[model samples]
Target: MPHDHEHPHSLLPPEPALRVKALETILTQKRLVDPAALDEIIDIYETKIGPRNGAHVVAKAWMDPDFKAALLADATAVVSELGYYGRQGEHMVAVENTDDVHNMVVCTLCSCYPWPLLGIPPTWYKSDAYRARSVREPRKVLADFGVELPVDTAVRVWDSTAEVRYLVIPQRPAGTDGMDEAALMALITRDSMIGTGLAIAP
Candidate 1:
């Protein structure tokens, strides 16, 4: 006779968030990590350093033609001068979205994201489903993200690697000519820099 019951662990959903929580618990129990310190760090990245940094870059590009040109030509060097160069962001390439084309970035092999600009990569970006589908059917992926481009607009996919990463510069929205850099930054979202969404219209 065999037992009909599944293992208790099997009852848990195969979600990465659950696994991360479990690991954190274990580390905390072992006194290897301080929850308070971890929370503070996460807060800093989420509120101060994450998407805001990328938005600053994007807004500067939108307001300064020379900066935009330099960013598109040599992203690593240009961003470095702005104090954005580090670790996973050691090398970057900025791809501008024009009327005829759009650009998106993904790391199929793993989540090789630009941490300095984007902070932590979103869970979906590291998922196997996104990693596979994004390359095979990018237009569909964009549509799923609620971004509908003109039929004539071309979608370009960039694969981030250990040595190089990409930042997508979404087109500047209309009615933004009078806005300053800080105001422009307010319109830029993390997904916009990832090319899954557009800048918010004023």
Candidate 2:
């Protein structure tokens, strides 16, 4: 008998939020995880701790040129000055996006990320597809993520290793010179630090 019934499995999301839900479901079904605990961790990453810390870092860097210079020179120390360091983010690197260069990050081996700053890494980031293709076809992958760079803009992909992870300092959007730190923080997002999206405009 040709069975048309689809096997029961957690339906994953096409976007970030629901993807976490799906990952949790899969782990729970395997009896390898606790849903409540997972939910709590996810909440902390999404709201209280993760992305907010990265936003502060990016906002401060944008506002102060000297700090920006220091950040680029020694990312680990500069990020530490902001007090963002933890399990998956012990070593940090900041890559700036300018008119001539677009920076992206990926862990080819696994889902190594700077969670202390950016929060729970996105589902797409941890996926095998992204790990494999981000290095080989970065331009195509960036296009899929909706970031289209200019033809002459050089794309640099930073491979996240066990010793170090990267944070992409997305180019500050135009017309935001007058915005304060709080306002600038609001413009930054999880994906912007991950190099898959841009900061919001004022």
Candidate 3:
């Protein structure tokens, strides 16, 4: 007979996260780990770092044509000038989305993402479904992500590898011309940089 009951572990967090939580709990009980410190670290990554760095780059590009040109020409050098370079981000390529072209990025192999600029890869980005579907049916994937590109817009999927990581610079929304870089940064989402979504409108 086939098993009818769900496995107990199925209800727990995914394997890696479950293991980390278990370890944290054990260390906390032993008074070896400071939960407060861990929380602060998590908060920093979740809010203050990663995607914010990419947003800053996007905002600057939106404001400065020279920087935008330089970013597209040599993403690694230009981005590093802003102090956002590190492992998993050594080689960077910036692709711009325009009225005629839409760029989407995916790691067909393991998730070789730009960790410094984008923070940790989202769980969805690392999934086998996304890795395969994003390349095979980019329009459908984008639609599922709530991004409906125009029929005339050409969708281009870039495969990210350890040698090169691509960042999508979403087209600046209309009426955002008066906004400053700080305000502009708020419009840039991580998903936009990943080419799965557009910049938030002001």
Best by lDDT: 3
lDDT of 1: 0.89
Best by TM-score: 1
**Which runs in model 2 stand beyond 4 Å of their true positions?**
1-47
What TM-score goes with each of the models? 0.80, 0.77, 0.79
Model 3 lDDT at residue 198: 98
The 10-residue segment of model 2 with minimum total lDDT is 1-10
lDDT of 3 by residue, 1-202 (tens): 4355967455446788887798788789999999999999789678865898999999999999999999999999999999988878889999999999999989998898888799989999999999989989999999889989888999999987557988899999999988999999999999999999999988
Clashes of each: 0, 0, 0
lDDT of each: 0.89, 0.86, 0.91
- What CA root-mean-square deviation does each model show from the true structure? 4.7, 6.6, 5.5
| Colliding residue pairs in candidate 2 | none
Query: How many clashing residue pairs are found in candidate 2?
Result: 0
Model 1 residue 138 lDDT score: 90
Writing each residue's lDDT as its tens digit, candidate 1 over 1-202 gives 4345976555445787896787788889999999999999889777766878899999999999999999999999988988888878988999999999999999999888888888898998898988998888998998889989999998899877568989999999999988988899999999999988999999
For candidate 1, the TM-score is 0.80
> Over the stretch 1-202, how does candidate 2's per-residue lDDT look in tens digits?
4345744333456687888778877889999998888778868776776788998999999999999999888888888877887778787889999989888889998788888888777889999989999999998998897888889989888887667889899999999997999999999988888888889887
TM-score-wise, the better of 2 and 3 is: 3
